[model samples]
Target: MDFSTPIMIIGLVAVMLALRVPVGFTLLISGTLGFAMSRGLDSTLQTLGARFYDIGSGYSLSAVPLFLLMGHMAIASGVTDDMFKAARTFVGHIKGSLVLATTFAAVGFAACSGSTTSTTAIFGKVALPEMMRVGVDRRLAAGCIATVGTLAGMIPPSVVLLVYGIIAQESIPRLFIAGIVPGLLTALAFGIMIYVRVMRKPELAPALPPSTRAEKIDAVKSVWAAILLAFIVIGGIYLGVFTPTEAGAMGAAGAFLIALFRGRVTIDAMKNVFIETSKTTSVIFIIMVGALIFTSYLAVSGTSGAVSAWIVGLEVNPGVLVILYLVFMLILGLFIDPISVMFLTVPIFLPPLVRLGLDPIWIGILVTKSLEIGLITPPIGLNAFVLKSVSPGFSFKEIYGGIWWFLQVELIVLAILFSFPELTTWLPDLMYGG
Candidate 1:
């Protein structure tokens, strides 16, 4: 095989992926073959070993597992329930208030969990029943749960941003800072979409009896632990009190303390958090190492350079190049998971980004925004499937239909980010001196 050809390497990867091979292995096999074809078997073996050592020992990557541990501990502590309860108490009486509350809960859970699938599943189990009891339309309830769950991806302490930082060689904390405005804007957009939707079509939601002042006070108190936890974790990061890694440690410890205070902590739960963190971290690291190996081959083979030249030679507008890349990402998301998409595309897409002198921080936000849309898109929409798995009673059509307006909201957000690059870069610059 003439591994000198980038297309040949890409084709092999696609075939292996089509056969359902694990992404890590697919990259490893393909990269190793290409490396050997270009630079002999001995050189390929040496490169693979060196790359693994470099990736495994990198200090920045240590943050990955700690953040994962924090998220899992928060979930195990039952903060999701408290957050949802608080949101419900305050917002459950307005038109489509239950849906509004779900969106709020999704944001809170996104803070703790940072996993869209988990947020959707937890809320689908918790919020959907209440929405049903209040006669909220099934399509609207399920769709909101599926779509709004993606708030976590844009929010600070996002695992996706962490991974992107590691790959893009950008600052992790700056990435975290950049996510703040965009995440809140996305959540607000979802809220507005719901309010307008239910208001125009009053049949979709029923107003509940408004809560009394005392009830509202009690609801606020119930969520004090969550508020405090977010402050310690997210606040600490924003205030420069600690690095993201330190914040992760504090967040995990705080989650455990909150769980203990609530009498929800147990040895088994702690054990499960560690076990799950380790599993998730291992998978992420494997994919990353494989991506590094493959990227090394691409660099040595000059394929990346050639692609960069070809893209630049076209003399297209940089904005158009970005839009085309985003469209490609959205289409790819229809078949693959977000992590795989990140690993496969970042290396290929990054060269063009640099050649065009685009800001990586802004590009990072755009990439994440696309991934957010991918989570709700049809076919392989991970969040939608999670909602369906949690509640099989809702038809897929109802669930997909429910997200149409929210999808429009997401598209608007994307356009805004594209038009105003400062929206993504402002906070990071303010905090980090750009």
Candidate 2:
């Protein structure tokens, strides 16, 4: 293999992505080609087989399916209705509070959903219609729904964070704990943004009459199961009562119980949940295995080393390098899905980043943050596409337009995290020790 092999593989993958090929296929083919060229066909096949076997049999990977099932079951249990009701009851009377309620509800749902697409879809069905019926601006409502859903990627039980922990070899529970403050900060920032938008326009969202005392009490009662489940699952992990994988199992079991209590469970529903979970987990795991193979190819070809050395020899400040790294991710996010971006870049960029003496956990959070922002960004924002599909009332332009302010709010939160690494690290350190 020559120096150009890695560049050729990257170019081929980029072309495949441009042609709209699935990311998993793109990585698999490109990596296999590179691996064969660098290490011979027999060795490449053997390495690929070994990598697949290791990833397939890993206990840690079991958490992927469990967490995914927990999200699907949470949706099946109709927790979104309770979440939205409780949030609306608390904040519905304030200006622009419908959107505010949606944001609050998103934070709660994020705990269980751990998926931006599912969270957005659920709210599209649950809250978007209510906001529309209440005469809220469709653009504002749809935009908030789309953007706020990205919170699921940042909150505890986040699949993105979990995958990051696995790839970066960081502690999963610490990653979960580290996300708490940033996730809440994101929700609060979104609420503040909505308030300012409505306060100035006074018509983007119409305030509703306050919930009666009884209504508030009822709402609280309705959401107690969800709250308890989250506390048990996430809190258990934080307290070291269980490993992250065990936490996922507890969460899945709890979601099933909630579905039973809500009378939402049925033979068909369980089958469907299982089917969906299987499909999702399979897709994620396949992509992951492909990433592992591709990364190994890169390693065997000395591509990572060459790239890392090239980056180091740039001789820029470490801070500037970090900025550039983030900027590249943000730009790449405009074109690629989060999972694809993760598989493609983390192996290449992260080794170099850690080589700079930056912390892996912090880089993981930063990468996750960039991916979260990408989900709401223009041109191929998956959450935005999912929103449009679920709520056809808003045009793509309208939905994208509504997202800018929230995007700005997210960027502000990202900047704060960027400026003060302590913000992302504090909780983890306090909980798990440095």
Candidate 3:
């Protein structure tokens, strides 16, 4: 294959998507054509088998559906609602605290969710209204909830990070561990930003009256559903009693229990939840398959190795090349969905990274972190769009504007992570006893 085949394939993908074609289909069609153009029709067909087997037979991929089912069940069962309600009560008393609470709460919520868009949509509906009613700034409230939605991908149990781990051949446990401090740090950064805004201009946030001790306790009791579910799912993963897949099953079961006992999820709703879960899981797997096809094509064409060599020939330092890759991901993220970007780039990009002897775990964290920031970055922040659907009286523009500072904060956080590999490595080392 010519050097330009990969670039042409990528450009065509953007054109197809720009014309509003479906994303998965765009990937499949582009990848297939790329293969056929390079290897002819017969070999493209042969590549299909290996693509399906690679993604289908993945034990780690099994965790995707299972965790997704858990999220669906969590929504259906009202566990999500309970958790946010608790967040409201706890944070409502402070000025602009509700907005801060959304960021704080999302870290908890992301522990169970798989999709960044879904997390934004769910919390936008659940958290935004309460904040608005409490006289929180509409844009601020909505953006925090939406942007933190990306936390669904940043924190442990994040399906995106799971996929990156699989593609990069990094440890799942390490990826999970690497995200913890950074996730919380991002949330804190958001919280501090919110607090400052409310402090400087009191009208943007009006504090709820102080809650009595009894009120606080009662509110705590109200959201135990979220806490319990998180404990069972996240806590279980860290305990090693079950793998991420088993934890997902356990979370699904747990979500069902929360709904059944609380009389929140009905028989009618339960069916829809299952159906949605299946649809989502299928879409993800298909994307995974498309990505594999493209990767296989790249491998066959020798484009991946050639690209790595070309990159090495750029004559800048290896670390500089890594930063360039990060910038490329950031730019791509502004225009495309993170998952598709991951599939399309990781396979082609990983070889160069490993060749440079960069730590795979560190690279995985960097990829996930950059993508997580992209979820809220402008031009086409998916989380912002998700929030648009549910934010009471806000426009996408306002949400985008509100997130600019937070975006800067995220960039700084990313810089720190990139500069100090130990930020991501220490927990994994301590946990693994290395």
Candidate 4:
């Protein structure tokens, strides 16, 4: 097979993406055509049948839907609302309280909800109005909601981290553990940015009446169950009491029970939860299957090996090489969705970096963080667009304007992760003795 064949297939995928084809179909169609051309139709057909079954039947992949179900159940249970209220009660008297509350609330919510768009959409509805009612600046409010939602991509139970673990064949539990510090640090950095901005401008966020002692206690009471559930899920994984899939099942069940106890789980809500889960799960699985097929074609065509060798032969500093790879992903992320970028690049990039003696777990976290930045980036910023859709009053300009501050904070966090791999590795190392 010609090396150019794989390059051509990648070009074809890009062209299809540019034409706005769904990502799964683009990968599927391109992989099918490229594999057939390189390895004959009979072989391609056999491979396709095997790839779909193998990818779908993987035990690890089962965690995806379970985690997603947990998120939907949390949403239905009004756990997110309680989280926001609790955060507000604590921070309401501070400058930029609403924005700070949203950031803190996002940290709690991100533990349960792994999907960034879902978090953004929910907050756009839940927090946006409260901020608006309190005379928060539209740009700041919209930007804060959109940017903070990316926390879901970083924190525990994150679907992005889970997918990276599966693809890179790393420990899912370790990846989840590794994310905690960086995720929290990112949240804290955003909070500081909000505080400073509101301090300088004073018009961006107005203070709310301070909560009374009873009100503060009540706020904590409202979210204690949800907090305990999160602790159990994360702690179980960290202690090796449950595998990621089992932990996901426990979390989902806990979420459902939370909803049930709250009387939030009506027949209609249950139906919606399952339907949404199926839809998200199907899309993710299809994309994975398609990416598998495409990557298999690249492997057979020797594209991955050839590219890895060429990259390694350059003798570039490992740090510079990693930075270049991240920059490439960031550029791709500005247009392509994060998952698609992961599927398209990870196969080609991981080998060379590992050869350079870089840690795959650290690399995974950096890649995930880069993708998180992509969510709020311009033009095709999916999170920003989701925020805009739910917030009809704000234009893309206003949303992106507010996002600019958070973007700098994201880059600083990314740099910190890169400079000190220990930040990403410490907890996971402590837990697993790595």
- lDDT against the true structure, per candidate, is 0.84, 0.88, 0.79, 0.91
Off by over 4 Å in 4: 432-434
Sort by lDDT, top down from the best: 4, 2, 1, 3
Q: Model 3 lDDT vs. the true structure?
A: 0.79
TM-scores for all candidates: the values are 0.96, 0.98, 0.94, 0.98
Better of 3 and 4 by TM-score: 4
lDDT tens string, model 4, 1-434?
Answer: 45777888989998999999989889999999999998899999999999988886899999999999999999999998999999999998999989999999999999998899899999999999999999999888988999998999989999999998888888999999999999999999999989998999988899999999999999999999998998999999998889999999999999999999999989999999999999999989888988998888888889888889998898679999999999998888888777778888898899889988999999999999998898888877888889878888899999999898999999999999999999999899878445
Candidate 2 lDDT by residue in tens digits, 23-136: 888888889999888789999889889988988888888898999999999989989999998999999999997899999999999999798888999999999989988889
**Model 4 deviation from native, Cα RMSD in Å:** 1.0
**Model 1 misses residue 99 by how many Å?**
0.5
As a whole number from 0 to 100, the lDDT of residue 230 in candidate 4 is 89
Better of 1 and 2 by TM-score: 2
Q: Whose lDDT is higher: candidate 1's or candidate 3's? A: 1
Compare the candidates by TM-score and give the number of the best one: 4
What would the TM-score be for candidate 1 when compared with the true structure?
A: 0.96
- What's the residue-level lDDT of 219 in candidate 4? 98
TM-score for predicted model 2 compared with the true structure: 0.98
